[model samples]
Target: MICIDSISFSFECSHTVLEQISCQIEPGHCLAILGNNGVGKSTLLKCIARIYRPQQGRITINGAELNSLSNRQLAQLLAYVPQHSNAPHMMVFDAVLLGRRPYIQWDSTSRDRQIVSALLEQFQLTSYSARYLNALSGGERQKVFLARAMAQQPQFLLLDEPTNNLDPRNQHEILRYLQELARQQQIGIAVVLHDLNLAIRYCDRFVLMKDAAIYRQGGPEIITPQTIKDVYGISAEIIEHQGARLIVPQMDHITKAADDAKTTANHH
Candidate 1:
């Protein structure tokens, strides 16, 4: 299990983004971090991945403090895919191959190439293996970045708004893939997401961050109607059917109905 104990973070000139936030990410589970904008969802992921240092508290992986591990050692244990991809002017195959750098020594090995090839195929990017990343669409580039993260073969994967560039079809496809990946590989996966329906459908764990702290954290029950109103400032209904929970956002007032009522009152 990965434990984040009372971690807080801030910038020198900005306000504190995270305040004593703590959570556990266990292997063989996928968690979705939910929050409105500027609530520090992305910053929390950065702190876990060691991209930004927290001012207070500690982060540990299986009881080993992250501070004790070197950069290479940390990379060996976790892989992070940011919200954006800044792939260099290189072929897709080569870009994905870079994830194996921590394991590669002296020169590229056949095993390295084999792993890269297998990922490309799994993502349906085999046809674009020779194409440059710059030539692909935004969604394609995002998928390539995800493939690279998988190539790392780490114990955990951290993703920030991974579905941003994907279409609706692709969004579900990618999330389903990650769901299976976590179940099959026993890897802990944390994704920062705003899509409540998708989160309920795909993830086994939920952590709802609010005002720089965790407002709620648990399973599907945490995403109740009142919880939605409290966290998102909106009314929503949760319905279960066919072995899945769906969040149906409630319409506050229907303008057409209001207008009809007004017309009826005027006639009366």
Candidate 2:
């Protein structure tokens, strides 16, 4: 498990991004970090990935302090996929094989090659294994990156907007895969997602962020209509369909405002 204890981070310019945030990423579950843009969702993930160290507080992964761990040691336990990745001219197989660096002493071994091959097949990118990353579409490249991260076989995985480039079908597929992977491998997974319904449907855990801090953290029950309205400032309804909770946001707010303006003009 990854325990974040009162971690707060800010830029050197005195602009605070995350404040006293605390959460946990438990094994065998997929935790969704949900919030509006600029509310420190990505920043929080970066904090966990060690890309940005919090100015205050501490983070411990599987009973080891994050600061005490070496870079290779940390990489063996946690893998992070960012919202965007640069498309290099490297072949897909070679790119994913790079993830096995933590385990390789001097040269790549057969086990590393096998892991890369299996990941390519698992993500349905075997045909594209020889293709360069820069030649693939955004969605394809995203899957390749995910496959590479999984090749690391880390105990914990952190992803920022993993579905950013995916279409609807691909979005569902990827999230489903992640959920199952967490269950089967007992690996902790924390994903920063903007799609509320997708988070509700695919994730078993939730962390709702507001004002650069965690507003609520719990099971699916914490994601209520009122909470949605409060955090997102949008009116929405939660409905149960076939034993699944769904969020239906009211899309007529703009039209209602326009009608109210017309009524005021007529009275004037």
Candidate 3:
């Protein structure tokens, strides 16, 4: 389990990015964080991943403070996949095997090789294992990065925009794979995503953020038209398709009229 309590962070002489944010993510669940650009979605994930320290809050993993864990110990518990991954012109298998660095002292062990090979096969990268990272396509590289994260065998996984550059098919494939991991391995996954429809389809729960603070959180049932208009400043229509909720943006005319009325009232 991961617990975030009143976490806040700010850059030097800059405005606060996160403000008193708190959330608990249980094991075997997938939580999706949704927000507009520059709303600190990535920052919150970084804090949980321990890349950035919170200025005024506590982050605990399984009742232990995050700061108390050593680097290898922390790596054993959590694996993080950032938004952008640039490989060092190395073989795909080599890059994925690096996830086992915490376990290997100096060189790759037999167990490490077994895990990496299994992950490569699982992600359909075994054929490309010998290929360099720079040679693969964008979607292929994304899969390699995800494979690296999975090779860590961490209980908790944090991903930042896992499907940022993929087409619809690859995006669905990647997210479906993640869902399977959470359900089968009982791994806790916290992902930052921009597509509300995708979040509604794949995520077990949703965390909505606005202006650097949590606006609301719940399942798809709680993500209504009012919530979208309030949190995203846009109107939308929600529909159910085969048990999954789909959010469709309403035409801008209605929203524009509402904004115009408000503007006229303010001038008056």
Candidate 4:
């Protein structure tokens, strides 16, 4: 399990990007972090991955503090997939092999090769193992990166906007793979998602951030129209479709009406 307490961070004296954020992510569960642009969803993911140090908070994996872990130790515990994937011009197999660095010595071991081969097959990248990273399409590269992370064999996976560059089908494919990983391997996953529909469909729970803090968090049932309007400043309608909650954004007609009402009240 990963536990965060009173985590906060700010850059260059600006307002805090994350404010006293705390959450518990348990094994075998998938969490989706949802927010508008610039709401610090990615920043929160970085803190969990130990990429950015929180000025005031503690992050612990299992029972050990994250700050105490060495780079190699951390790499073995957590696998991070950022929004953008840029790999060297090497073959896909070599790229995925980088995930084994934490386990292998200076040279690749036979076990490492076996792990990579297995992951390539699992991600359906065996056919493209010899292709260079630059030659693959965006979705293919994303899968390669995921395979690289899976090769690390980390207990937890952190993804930031992982579906940003993929088509709809690939998006579903990647998320489905993540869900399968959580069930099959019992790994904990935290992913930042912009698509509310997909988050509702795939995520087990959600953490909604606004104004540099966690505004509300729960399952999809708690994501009401008022919640969306309050957090996102946009009107929306929520409905249930085959047991899943669907959020549909509406135009700002009520906003204009409210403004007109305020003007009339002031004139009177």
* Cα RMSDs, all models: 4.6, 2.7, 3.3, 4.1
Tens digit per residue, CA lDDT, model 3, 131-238: 999999988998899899888899999999999988999899889988888899999999999898888888897899999999998776778889888888888999
RMSD of 4: 4.1
User: How many angstroms is residue 257 displaced in model 3 relative to the true structure, after the best TM-score fit?
Assistant: 8.9
What lDDT does model 3 reach?
0.90
- Which ten-residue region of model 1 has the weakest summed lDDT? 249-258
Ranking by lDDT: 2, 1, 3, 4
Candidate whose TM-score is highest: 2
Q: Rate the local accuracy (lDDT) of all candidates.
A: 0.91, 0.93, 0.90, 0.88
Top lDDT: which candidate number? 2
Q: How close is candidate 3 to the true structure, as a TM-score?
A: 0.92
**lDDT of model number 4:** 0.88
List candidate 3 segments past 4 Å from native: 254-268
lDDT of 2 at 253: 71
Worst 10 residues of 4 by lDDT: 249-258
Give the per-residue Cα lDDT of candidate 2 at 132: 94
Number of the candidate with higher lDDT, 3 or 4: 3
List model 2 lDDT by residue over 1-268, tens digit each: 9999999999899778999999999999999999899999989999999999999999999999999999999999999999978987899999999999889999999999999999999889999999999999999999999998998889999999999999999999999999998999899999999999899999999999999899999999999988998899878889889998889988797478678889999999
Q: What is the TM-score of each candidate against the true structure?
A: 0.93, 0.95, 0.92, 0.90
- RMSD of candidate 1 to the true fold? 4.6
